[model samples]
Target: MTKTILITGASSGIGKETARLFQAKGWNVIATMRNPDSESELSTLENVWVTKLDVLDLDSITKAVNDGIQKFGGIDVLLNNAGYGAYGPLESFSRDKILRQFNTNVIGLLDVTKAVLPHFRQNKKGLIINISSIGGKITFPLGALYHGTKFAVEGISESLHYEVEQFGGQVKIVEPGMIATEFSGRSFDFSNDDSMVEYQKIVGALMGAMPAMAQNASPSSVVAEVIFEAATDGKNQLRYTAGEDAKMLIANRQQYDDATFIGGIKAQFGL
Candidate 1:
């Protein structure tokens, strides 16, 4: 019997690649996004079940979970992949924007997991794959808010694993370093149009290098493969680091304590 997986943020970036890969592997892929129709390419896949979901919206998450359970017979895997980066100095970001980041990246994921747990516990078998970022493990300039949200995911995923282990449910987090995605294009509240005067000196330099960073990063395929491994592979580890850069990142963090490691990271960002 083919397994079924539900992937959020499936309209683009790593989520899109993951959806395509699972469909090819013969798993029933439920590709979810806030607006499914925005990406016509996803609509063409016969094995994919596209649904509308906004992570911040509880009604949408609950309804989508029910709809997925009905069609797929219960989701074997749930990929929490809907999150955006809110880059720039902490001072430049509004409280509302920071809250939005945490809501989608941290709380929204929890809500989705809550919606899907009953189904998983019923079967006593399921995998929860969370797409966290390397920023979760390491600090960087102009990414304090984004990193905070991801760090929450890292902690939440770690905690949930132990909580659900007895029930045969697993939670795994994927930490990817920068990847070639529209995150740069859709950087929430990190305005290219309006510069923050206070941090423009560094922010401008960082923005100028943003394009280079995207180019040096791995493609979505790197993250997609790691997601597949985390979902289906054995050993059931709590975390999977995606991409070469991410591997090096985890290594650096493990090699040094907080002060040294974080300072190294700060240096890397030219802060």
Candidate 2:
């Protein structure tokens, strides 16, 4: 039987790579993004359906899921990889920006998962892989909003597993460190008020450190491989960390207390 995987934010980065990987492995892929018209590569692939799906839009979520299921017969896996990084100080953001972050990352994920649950329930088996970040377990200098949303994803995926497991559904989380992608380009949102003098030092520090930090970024393909493993390994694992940096950082976070961990971050940021 041919299995199908539905991937959100599949126009680029880890999502696009994962779509290609699964398709190559003989799985039908529904590669969804906010604007499918702009996509050229994945659309040309066999057994890959490129469709429109904006995470903030519930109607689009439902329609995308239904359309994919219909196109591929049935969806065996769902990869919730549609989210951007919202950085900068919390106070610098407008209400709309704040709401957009939470809505897209938190509420929108729940809505998509809700739409897919019925199909999984009917089939008696399914896997949901959420693309969280290393930040989900540890905080950065100016990622309050971004980290907050990922933290929410961690909690949500953990709790939802218990409920979904009763019906043979499983939830898995992939925590990837800095990935070599356009994530810092079109997918990144940074808000800052220059007039806010208090945040200048930390902002400058983060900006200065970014280049060096990016030097060690693992390619999106690395995370894609991990996603493939999570989908097919069929293990009872709940969390999989991708990238050497993510493994080391997550291990440190698990080993250290609040003061020690936070102090380490502060020292790294020159705070």
* Whole-model lDDT values for every prediction: 0.85, 0.92
Candidate 1, clashing residue pairs?
A: none
lDDT of 1 by residue, 1-271 (tens): 8899999999888999999999988899989999987879877887788999898999999999999989878789999999988887777667788889889889899999999999899889899999998889886667788888988899898988997788998988899988876455463457333555767776776776677667668999989999998887876688888888788878988999998987775676577
Cα-based TM-score, every candidate: 0.93, 0.98
**Among all candidates shown, the one with the greatest TM-score:** 2
Writing each residue's lDDT as its tens digit, candidate 2 over 1-271 gives 9999999989889999999999999999999999999999999999999999998888899899999888889999999998889889888999999999999988888998999999999999999999899989999988999999999999999999998899999999999999876447766898898999999999898888888788889999999999999999979999999999899999999999999999998888888
TM match of model 1 to true structure? 0.93
CA shift of 175, model 2, Å = 0.5
- Candidate 2 pairs with clashing backbones: none
